[model samples]
Target: KTIFPPEGRHWSILEEKFLALVAEGKVFFGKNGESQPGLIRYLSEVEGLVPWTWWPHEEVGHTDESKKEIQQLFGKSAAFDTPKPERLIKRVLEIATNPGDLVLDSFAGSGTTGAVAHKMGRRWIMVELGDHARTLVAPRLQGVIDNEDRGGVTEATAWKGGGGYRYFRLAPSLLEYDKWGREVVSKAYNSAMLAEALCKLEGFTYAPSETEYWNHGHSTEHDYLYVTTQTLTHEQLRDLSEQVGEGRTLLVMCAAYRGDARSLPNLTVKKIPDHVRDRCEWGRDDYSLEISALPMAAEPKPDDVDLFGAPAK
Candidate 1:
């Protein structure tokens, strides 16, 4: 509200407004950097919930409860020795994150973190290297998704689980080094796998056609990819070119091909391993950042000095 004369000025609030404020409990600091007569407003504030340092098992959960949780999901045979309580995980998640935030538990023992995160409406990634990942962790997460298991913070968070998660298994590296240190596709990869891998590398979706042998994948309607371990002859290329027809192109990856491959208009022929060798890391396994692997920095010259006049070391 605007006041005509807000002259009873204090440092910021006008004195007249301040006195009027004191008289009617209405005068307060106004926009003119002073309290003015009949000019008043108030601001309200809300205190947020304070985070506590201590979490008691009585409130979150204890080991016995966690064991029972595992037992309920998969029976005693699959229970982890060091499984964490779901409520414990829930408490931590509630404090640290909000709905739809991602939670990563790299050491996912019994998948308590994932289950709690999911129930709390958060996305999660759980990694377990042990075999229990399949036997214990996966089954536990499945229970969380199905809504059948409501033991932990499920009821507290009001989560009726329905979302699903993806699972992946790590396979051995696809490339290996031959006797002469030449990079080649691993023998472990069959023709189908090789084709799929090459398709992915070439940015094509791998969808093998049932009717057409040459159709391993396609980048577009007119562009197709064919992968093979067989050595193609000139006649085979001629046949493939004919089948591919006009307004269509084919990328042919073969072990080796006889005769001039460029003569075919529709086919772009490439040699396996030779065309692909540089694209992948071959044969080596250890990728750890070892101290010895790093190039040592030369010791600073004893005569060198920094800008601050400190001796270099």
Candidate 2:
């Protein structure tokens, strides 16, 4: 993923997009100016695997050597101007995906995704629209499969064996206007798709609820969490609070509130705008900003310097 500056220095546009993506459970950002623009790639299909904050390259083991190797390999090529580092992709693959799992990279670029996938014993499918797809993406991936050491992965130990991949180009969007020019919705993903996407975005494991009134989902720790887009009355809060597990924190996100959130014990009622705004801020400004200029002292000579000054006196 790459971070580009706001389109026209329009912070509002960027904020709106950021908030919308966050609400949809996409990506997160740190405090203003402390974050870079990038996409969070999902390497596995696990709930709560998506991070709630941006992780720096240093934090993810992206070393200077690895970065230099990647730049040398694909930086000269005009075909892939924004190629991601293989080490970065490898880390994501290690965390989210397993061996033999299918990995897809629609914007294949320099084929880092495919190369990493091949080395990690996973199958990959890549899509590239440009003419250099063959010259650039293909050769990079071939180097990985054939274990060519163009970038630094030696043939002897890097990819001692071979792997396979299939390339394809998909339409812009599944939805297209008919001859009559009317709107059309594709059946690519129905309710199940929406639920799965929601689950992925919201860091929840999707499950059907026994009761009709409550939606069912759990975190990675198997803690029961209920989310509703409706207001909770006092009776509803009391009843729901009773259903909360012992020694567990009951977090509830609601649209409107009628009763006081402090009334419910062991329950953390999070109001949308207030909670999000409170948690997310531009900067903390905790550090000191004062600066001073002082003259540097010259080193003293052993003979010229006084030896405890009092002995001479």
lDDT of each: 0.81, 0.58
Query: Candidate 1 regions off by >4 Å?
Result: 1-53, 62-64, 177-182, 233-239, 257-266, 274-277, 281-313
Assess candidate 1 and give its lDDT. Answer: 0.81
Best-performing candidate as measured by TM-score: 1
Residue 73 of model 1 has an lDDT of 81
Q: Write the per-residue lDDT of candidate 2 for residues 78-159, one digit (tens) a residue.
A: 4344556566677677777989899988787767787778887888888878776777778777767776635543332256
What is the number of backbone collisions in each predicted candidate, taken in the order shown? Answer: 13, 2
* 1-313 per-residue lDDT for model 1 (tens digits): 5444324422334457455547875543546746433433333322235578888889888999999988888888876898888888888887889899999998999898999999888999988899988987888789888898878788888988799999988765667789998667798898899999899888888999999999999999999999998899999999999999999999999989998978898999998888776676555888665687788788643212111212223
